[model samples]
Target chain A: MAQLRSLLLPTIFCLGGLMGNYFDRYTQSKNIVAEKASLVTTTDNKCSLGDIPSSAKEIMKFGFPSCENLKFREDYVLSYNRVHRTANWVIEHLTADKVFQRDFKRKSSMFKEDTSVPVLFRSTKKDYRNSGFDRGHLAPAGDHGYSLKALKDTFYLSNMSPQVGVGFNRDIWKRLEEYTRNQTRVYTDIYVITGPLYLPKESAEKDGKRYVKYQVIGKNDVSVPTHFFKIIVGDNRKKKSNAQLQLQVFQMPNEKISKGTPLDEYKTSLKSVEKASGLLFLDKASSLAIATDRSAI
Target chain B: MAQLRSLLLPTIFCLGGLMGNYFDRYTQSKNIVAEKASLVTTTDNKCSLGDIPSSAKEIMKFGFPSCENLKFREDYVLSYNRVHRTANWVIEHLTADKVFQRDFKRKSSMFKEDTSVPVLFRSTKKDYRNSGFDRGHLAPAGDHGYSLKALKDTFYLSNMSPQVGVGFNRDIWKRLEEYTRNQTRVYTDIYVITGPLYLPKESAEKDGKRYVKYQVIGKNDVSVPTHFFKIIVGDNRKKKSNAQLQLQVFQMPNEKISKGTPLDEYKTSLKSVEKASGLLFLDKASSLAIATDRSAI
Candidate 1:
């Protein structure tokens, strides 16, 4: 444990320093409390005007990816990327009770346009009809099975991305989602932020240049992300207020992955995800020490 | 003129209908007056805590493209795309006095990183170095020549994008900037919004897929937009309270164009630009009849 701590201390400090700068900028750009309160009052049915929803506050306890077009859902909060016709990021807070309840059926929910988004920017069912890609959920539907409304809210097209089917979305990506839900057994609370990435690769021309290339499907020209990322933070604060949290970040290619591949193969550093996605995660919570152990949960 | 109006009325009405929905969403998502007032007071050097800069109010009089990471400068307003390490869009309100008054020398200014942006998301000079692309200005420096500070503000890397050096940025793009500035001679006020686009092209693999492909330069991986667009709105309301405005939109590829090609050849419909860019232009001002004449200026 001492050896591991020695190794991880530098990374933790580095991230802590970087996040300090980011946290300042985030606060200056958007007043999170006021914005969240306003969003909850306006969009959420359970909350009246001037009343803040506890679900939104708990789900976004860490930090927001970007403060563009935000949607506060019943069980999750999302920032929509209008240009991509999909979510920039969707965040959810999961507990053992929420994941294990299974009070709702996924089959009962149907994918529909999020009318909260203007028609011009909203993704539709037709965009993915013959596009050969699945309407993959950013915030997996299984995680919000505690209530029917929560499960149905996950079906909004705004929360969907054009993800590869067969081996990727159905196989390995589903495994990741299952693994995330299972983590609720170990930690008191699990905070997860999932989003798409259009990463660059070295050009095939051998010209020493890198290019970001992605496909667009249908008339709306929805962007097919090159990869998807999930950053999971497991909080053990209920056990002891000062207990270190476990941080695990994964980046998987939006393509087929062989079965039996270890989930740890996709584990990545938080800095790389932040740099590529142009978002800062856990900035507000960086004051607390975070353990970087792969075997933690 | 009557024949042109008859042909253009449908497009205008369609855009008006579409924008009606968008304007409502825009207003709900962002209280333009409050946000602008807050942004001006926070960022502008000349303005005190409660004073809203008239410059920002005027430049963004029509509508904002996306209000993510907006930087309100002395002469222009920009929405920064942290993921791309470049400006998403920059809006500039030009007048005959501002464009014609050459108070600053181009050589006096130097391109530098925008310190206001968190260093993790900033685009540095090194990103453009040896990348075989020009540090092209979104809001042309020539238009801000009325003041040294305004000219210097244009040098911020936030306002720069990677563009083809010789044929595009130097020769053709320069001509476009010149043409935009020259328009101030004809119109009392010219509002121009310029930005990059990562438009998709039909896949070469014959898979019937469309792919958005762009190169990334240097360590920061600043995106090289596949195309660039400029939407110019000429307002003659000063002459009469309800005088019709002339609106022209152009999209040019980020590569070499034949030197003798006329600028009008790149003229495109506003709907096409809005669709490809995933942004609404002049949405708030849609109630005003806009002339679609290429020769209006």
Candidate 2:
């Protein structure tokens, strides 16, 4: 009986691996179709809207975190959080073709309210004025420098969150964005999902209770997220059909980080981010090749 | 010239009133059809599911707050907030027939996890067990005493929030629920929408900044809302076609409340609740019959 069981184990493992690969491909294709359909609808709404690019389809090849108030832009897509007057999450597809092309300058882009959103829920420039915190971009402006419209779209208040300036947004957060862009040189395609998080912290009173606290800036009451997260997927599609996809998840505190702090220290598991953000990541990917080895970072 | 101006003023007022009434009826009928269609889909899901009751249709006469994760129950319908492990809002259609029927007793109902919700986001009875807060029902069980299944449905953890037990949930909150049921005697139909709110409060440091803070309980991290809100719309449908509809909105803190404090003190404008909750109320209604006179309370 022991010999028979051992013989069956190998066969079962082979079948499971085949099924996983098949399912992953099926899901990837299904998501691409759905995303393309949505982009088509967006194109129909605006006559001047740019052509639907295949890059958008490849970016959302895995799956969407959540489908609510989705704004399909020229270079990226974001789900706006109407209540918080900010984005729930933003998806950006990075490649050597787009990130390397620098046709537009950031100087001409202006921060403006997203007129597509209802006036009642819209966030404005006045809300961020004198509010000490910087209007941080979720889809970094530098990533969309390939097109003038895409660069300007990143400046919408809907894409902005109230982020700390000196030590956080401008310093460590910028480094992370640059690091993500640098990966385009290594991987053929890079898909990124970035969003804010309101995490709970254990109270100081030792009352055995946890509390979530975050400041609201401006009249719109835009929530200053306690933390921010990014999930990066690196795919080398040119490789064999069974080529592994590299996954890396990072979560950073909204406050200041010392200059010497290693970026690897912020790395976290995908499950932790999903639980905290109330969002699921890459569910369509039957198997995630999480770069568990520290050397991968 | 004075005579002409006075005549035009009255004519303009009359025209505005006519348009408002016509628009209100048109919107109301549209909502009814949309809600009925949704109920039909819910019915098709489970063969054993209870029949589609007209009460559920009447409860949602005003359009839904937001359509994300909706759970259509026997007597009440709610939009579940998967992130918070609680209902975004629960709507109950109260009437002289349902609330006063007393066909089911509360003792027979048991607090159980809602299996309909995904296991990752579901809250359990264990989460509330020693959590220092009561499993307060957003749709009060007493409001569904007419049917055994309806009463038991209210016990689902999805319908609960971590509410203060003694001074709040049991004492003042109970009174408010009872008060809502009693309104059925006056109005032919009383539609109540109850939900939790994490309202922002100004900090004590005089820094001129506002913050939202709330406690979370157990492994599931079910949010303990800082406040609760109810929007009560009373309609006397039996009256003339142009009869007015009463609108009353209230918001209460999640902490303790004194016994002597009048419930009227909690009454607030609908606009304030909408702004804070990130929801719209009765947008389909042509005009609100706001009981401006304190005597109406």
Candidate 3:
């Protein structure tokens, strides 16, 4: 186990944990814009597990609701551990844990929500396997720097689900990640919405064993992700009845016969790190896009 | 209908008509690059379709490849126009009809390859009735200030596709656009690759339609699009190529459970225009990108 650092300087500045408290008080009695913290001190800025405890905002959940039971899918579970300011929810067996640290450049794209991300999977140990599914990784290590934990969390069997790489290997997936990173500059925090997208069992596959792979993927033929999620961390102060930045991550099945995915392409992304994660987010991009649309008017 | 300007001056400068000659000469001779104009006609440059028809090197198609036949299914159609320009290809939409105006605050980005561009949908008709789906736009108008024809061509029924907004009212969408405009000074000709993403049927709908929508979009949703292809207009040449930039837009099945679209949401999109004719060359982004990718790789 790697010893973690305890830097909170960026946390305070980045998360505005202190400001989060101030906003709580400020909104309490219309206290203007709340007390302004000219600067964040390392003291209160640490990303304590307390910050994201069970009570923490379940802002977004991917995989199955049952995965939320924690114990049910302990194998794929990534617990938040503080290495100073960085909170890493780690895994142990990524689909391709070893290929993560290379200097492979992602394709140019408008968004890279899931480029370079590690594929996760659903664990057979969790009773969610064999129904024709795949283990998908919600928290991908490929996009972020190479942290041993980051790589491991990618393989957390519980995090896996059946998924088709929408723009996988292509640029769309990488561009989405870039888009999310860009969001950090303007917003105080970012809440991401990501999950696996399953396909019908008979959509398409290779020799009935290999699934259609993506470009620029790991040793496993899984296409590098083509999509990711991004919900800028906004002040949850209002606890606004509606999600401020809700998003969805999905893997689109290849529609036409020649787009590369063979006919009889698996409608459902497979199961098993050996197969595909038979999982997908509850909704698709359109479902979550409504979150941004204000119904007030 | 608005009569388009002569565009002759730009036509000569951009080498709009010389596409055919350029293709045989340039395509056969793989070592060619877009020639830089020596004349100081620094008529401020912005993103435009001027360079597309003659610039592409490869035309790797994404999604399911279908003939001109068959009804378009938002989730079962092409996913993107992956263009490889020899080490890079800017992913963008081209129209058979000239439309859109490149208006940006700087030159570098406008001149650079596609960087960030969002997928937009323009209805083929005003009323969402009759059409089995909502008119969708692939290249959104928000990214550029194209001419009416430029904008209109983008709304070609062939250009629209099913889409879903990805975030809150996609407030981040516009912000992302602004961010791209602001970041131009830092990078230029950012090779881009953007396209439609099929999430699934009823994947996630706004009111009742499943659409892929976004707040911010870039020219090439990637850090660096691999297959690079481009063409330079030498104020002389003949137009060539038959591949057109097609926009496949789509919307979801309307749900009475949803309120009427907001008045502010009323738009003058491409779907509302009459059929187009002429030297249709604008709708050619994906094709050119494909050429660029092919020649380069």
Q: Which candidate is the best by TM-score?
A: 1
TM-score quality measure for candidate 2? 0.80
Q: Is the docking of candidate 3 incorrect, acceptable, medium or high quality?
A: incorrect
Error of 1 at B223 (Å): 0.4
Judging by lDDT against the true structure, name the best candidate: 1
List residue ranges in candidate 1 displaced over 4 A: A1-52, A291-297, B1-52, B291-297
The better candidate by DockQ, 1 or 3, is 1
Give the worst 10-residue stretch by lDDT in candidate 2 chain B: B39-48
lDDT of each: 0.76, 0.72, 0.25
* Candidate 3 lDDT (Cα, 0 to 1): 0.25
lDDT per residue for candidate 3 within B1-297, as digits (tens), equals: 111222322333334223312221101222112322111000010111212222232221221111111111211121222110011111342322211235422222221111111111111133223322333333444443445333333333333332223421133333333333333333322222322321112223233222221211122111111111111111001233443222211122212213433322321212111010000111223334334332332
> lDDT by residue for model 1 over B1-297, one digit each (tens)?
853442232233223222322112101222321221121111100010112367888897765565556777899998788899998899999999999999898899999888766666789999999999999999998999899999999999999999998889998889999999888888899999999998999999988999999999989899999999999988888977787778888899999988978888898977677777777666446432564452342
TM match of model 3 to true structure: 0.22
Candidate ranking (DockQ, best to worst): 1, 2, 3
Sort order, TM-score high to low: 1, 2, 3
Query: What's the C-alpha lDDT at position A128 in model 2?
Result: 90
Relative to the unseen true structure, what is the C-alpha lDDT of residue B217 in candidate 1, on a scale of 0 to 100?
A: 93
